[model samples]
Target: MKRRTKKLLLNWRIILLTVFLIGSVVTLAVRPLTFGIDISGGVALVAQTEHPVDADTMQLVVDSLQKRLNTLGLRDITVEAQGDQIVLVKVANVTTAEEADAIKNVIESQGVFYMEFDGVIFGTGQDVEYVGIYQIKPDNTWSVPFRISKSAAEKFAELAKGKTGWPVDMFLDPPVNSLLVVPDSVYNLMNSSEFNAQVPEAPTLLQRITKAFNITVVAYANQTADELADMAEGREKIVLVDLNQGLQSELENMNVTVRLVQRGPGESDHALIIRTLGLYGPYSVGEGLATGQPQQDVQITGTASDRLTAEQEARQIYTVLKSGSLPVKLNVVGMEFISPRLGENFKYQALLAGIGALIAVFAIVYFHYRNWKIAIPVASTSFFEAIIILGFAALIQWNLDLPSIAGIIAAIGTGVDQQIVITDELLGGTKETRITRRSNVLKRMGRAFFVIFASAATTIVAMSFLLIYFVGTLKGFAFTTILGVVIGILVTRPAYAEIAKYLLGED
Candidate 1:
């Protein structure tokens, strides 16, 4: 009996089963699994394009958005094109309202990028060749160096010839209202000798103003108040600026007045940023345009309170420069922010549902077989198949959302059904057939697997449609279901057949 058991354990089917079970357990314990937005809290947004677009164009839009969102330091993000012109976005772990709003603004708004040298439009997003960060100074303050198209570079060289010592402002959706522009001089000043004392509180100033104020405030770099007039339309716009005599005079001349309110820290809930170009005193490029060489590789740098903030700012700048602008405008039609607590509840309920399903399957299988030797292996094999499926999910970092969990349950049901077929074929025969030769048992198992394989193939064909055409939760369900079916046919079912043959003394 010991020799027989040893041979059974050494069988290829048993060996494969043992290896997979061990690997699954190790992967579950070590790597852990990534959860989707439905399991982990996050924001789900469905934004519709202003008009219907061709399939290829919609795909391009989705791809662009995916690339842009990836630059935002978010690892778990899904951007998929759905329906005629709708794009579905899911970002995990975005719990705070402030973060969600900021992300939403970025997602909904088209990033119109422009590079201006001394107020001349020299390049757009199309001209951006590359963007990256490099540490120039010994202090480890990083700089973002970007290259523009050769044509734009030549144009910049020409336009910048006379204005060698002037500042350049890079804008996203230019003019002013959007409040997304970075002056070339701010980069220098932040890296200069007087940075520590003159920079003010970088944290307090650089943060995107989250406080609610009565009047709308807009910030610009090089653009004058007259140029920003359209941004102030239909709203009470209050312009705020650093205590600059020249900027104040420019605003007065442009008929856009500046109002300075005196308030201590935490005094009121209202705050606005005007971010003037000349805020950091006069600093020039110093006849660098005298070189007049094509300014293809230009470095833009800025200050942040910490390394994390600097990385974020760099990524945001890179995204704006790279993504440029969406081809068509998008308006958010549906937005749902799932709280982590609710997601936790859903996860718990899903677990309970799976447990209940397994228990019910066990009872039904045991009652049908009326023998522990037959029912135990069947139920155990089904349970083992589930573990293997989950292990594969974790190994591949597939997010387990509610739909995925449902898929696992559904797959286990299919597995149990197949296992029952194998058990019945081996056990429920005439006395002569039941006591048949090992070769007969092998033939019976082959017949049972033929039925199993055919069923598995049909199920796979059905789920393939859902996996391909669907984009959201349904796709996940189909994926898990198909994966489970494949594993059942290839791995678990074969191992179960071998084990059942050994247990029934068919060998």
Candidate 2:
């Protein structure tokens, strides 16, 4: 080779060498290889709704679920829709069976309500203007005040006339005294005749007086504004209350039941309004149920099972039923669980098979090129592509299942083919002039790039659909395949082409 050609080759070699060194460092430092759930056993649940659910709706649910799972600090969690009606959830590093069950329970409890209070003021000696409790924190700490409507302020003053400085409990539900606010004056209220007359009947009278106090309040239970608006028309005003722990225990243990006296034509069939206080709330009404029916006793049919797993599952079922039903019903028509032992065995076999295929391809390229110089670059580029793909998989925490392995193998084959195309263009030199020759090589490579880009685009589209519409291992395959093809086209293939041009004295 001429000195100039040697210089060019040296320069190109240095560039390739630098890329190889940096790629090696990145590969070693990053060590991106993801472990799938199959190797690390985790929980998998398949839920199906009753109605047909579209992808958009399912995606929303999955996004909400992802947020909840993240809040719980769970790792390697995957939630996706399998079909139109079914959703699949997989979580890794689950410490206990109860954790899995709790996840299921949370998913079942789709309605989440959060509230915050603004401010509270004590009742004056004259009258209480408005009574309400404000939440001070996310944990439900509250401040309460004795409030009376402007119209009823006079009656409040009469009831509290001589009882100034007396402490009155602000009941959130029953037995839950949120706070106690006392009037400023006591002597003026104690000397009044109204104080003595109401002293004996104070408790009962106080209850009646408090009941008449009207306060403006805002409440939300995760129902959308549109849903609330639709339900608000012709809906009778109802008071909802949150119960304290003591009140919840009392209600749970009591034999109290609720019955409706009448049913309205517009009422839902599943509605069952209760007057009794329960664990989470007072005067709880079952959602999606009809209203205005004759009142009947309600027996808490739930029983604690001896087995914790069974009890937890039951609670999940109850939550799902209580929350509105799913838009689409799903049936787990098929499920397959591969044991860790099997996974290990398959992995070993897959490793051997991949090595064998790679060796065979490298040997064929060496014979076809008849030049060790060309074969080395081709083999190195192919190996580099595979390593980079795996490194990325590990870095991004992608699950590497059998299907993902297959994708990497396919990417390697495609990469080798691309390298061969570059080699052929460099060797042919069919153009009459030197510039024409160079232009021809570039045009050929450009066409090759277009074909590769188009192929990658199609694969991405297909994989995206699979990821969006399917679940489990298939999604793993699609994800890895897309990643591999994108990286091979954008990075490895271009680098290989540059190396080939310098080797063939085209530059």
Candidate 3:
């Protein structure tokens, strides 16, 4: 082949590679993926434990939770221990109240293992038992397992008429504890005569079940079993109890007796007993238990969603309760749901902002290069980088929230900077000394790589911290930024360099 022809072939080869890279990005952009809060949201919970838990132990707990979240198929999830008693978790794409609640439940859940035989208690509470420490799903749901006593499992199953899995009613106890309930059908079959005699028309199955399985939850700060029993006098209450030394001390020192009161005639009344089992503090026990004394103490604030789904969410809460009390009890210091209007407006602003930034970059590159040959490649590379990022996001089903959008914009800038370097080096050289020019261009590219690498590393570090220390928007920005920088470095930069070199006949 002629020398010119040989050079042309080499150039075409480089062009082909760049095209392939760009094409792949295009394909990905058309179909992007995203992650959920469990996958990508930051969750920091400061639980007030009845006892002091060291940092190492807290880290262990967080690590366990992170594993659970990973099991759920979430990527980029981080779990860490903050201070002596706080566990911090950060994930991406947890944008809604429902998602946040779901993540919280998973982080807080204490899972237990149980085996049931027939409808009677057969073994001791600790036999062949495990608890769920954490569990996670790709869609951002996590469940943790812990050990439980075999006897407790049997008792719970007996109470639940041989139904065993996750005990819905045992959230107040350690995750390993069991709570059982007789189903409505069994109640109807067993109490038909009395039920019929009391009400000739008899209520529906649901009503009967509700009446038969009535339960109430209460929270007590510090009190012995005797004190709790005294408070429950004149009331038919199913008492869910937790004992910790710290809670006991707090109550005693404060001269406080906490009780939860529910007024209504029902099949069963529920009360929560918070006491110190040891010298530490009161560990939380009981699901759906009220906090404080009747008309006093800290109340379980916030209205719950209607039944069904709310109950399911409550089951998640129960899972956390089962896990055990947090290292420190955290009061809901701030609880504000993102309003729909605000979310919409924020999304709009983010989209517009990203578009504006991209257009500005494109204009600057086009005008600065002053040649369509150079500007085209830079612009194409920028566009290709975005497609790839978006495609990956869509393929992963990553939620394209506001912060993530910003990450995409930042990636665009990074891509542009790299492209500018490639264009400068390529255009400054000639075809007569192609090899020397190519060497110089590669050297320039290396310097750009160093800068890009450093920037990406710094961004990753910042994101990691935000992901661990903060929640909500800050976390979103961190996640998106990290992802964008990663994509820019790995996919976009090299492809643009190749394109620039090929265009300049320097390949």
Candidate number of the best TM-score: 1
Query: Candidates' TM-scores?
Result: 0.63, 0.51, 0.48
Across 1-507, the per-residue lDDT of candidate 1 in tens digits comes to: 787788889989888988998999999999788899988999998899999988856875775576545433355889888887889999998887866775687678766566654335677777887766444344435566778899998887886565544555454432233222223343333333332222232212222121111223333456665665555554333344333446546655666644322222232221211122212212234365436787677765666677777776565555555557446877878889999999999999998998898888878877876777777887788889889999999998898899988998899999988988887788746324574576777788888999999999999999999999888999999999999999889889889987887887766
Superposed on all Cα atoms, the candidates' RMSDs to the truth, in angstroms, are 13.3, 19.4, 16.6
lDDT of 2 by residue, 418-507 (tens): 677667766763333332376877887787787778877887898899776666787777777787787777777777777777676665
Q: Which scores greater on TM-score, model 2 or model 3?
A: 2
Cα lDDT, all candidates: 0.68, 0.50, 0.47
Q: Which numbered prediction scores highest in lDDT against the true structure? A: 1
lDDT for residue 228 in candidate 1, whole number 0-100: 54
> Candidate 3: minimum summed lDDT over ten consecutive residues — where?
273-282
User: What does candidate 3's lDDT look like per residue over 262-287, in tens digits?
Assistant: 12122232111111100011112123
Candidate 2 Cα lDDT to native: 0.50
Report model 1's TM-score to 2 decimal places.
0.63
Candidate 1 versus truth, CA RMSD in Å, comes to 13.3
Q: Where is the poorest 10-residue window by lDDT in model 1?
A: 272-281
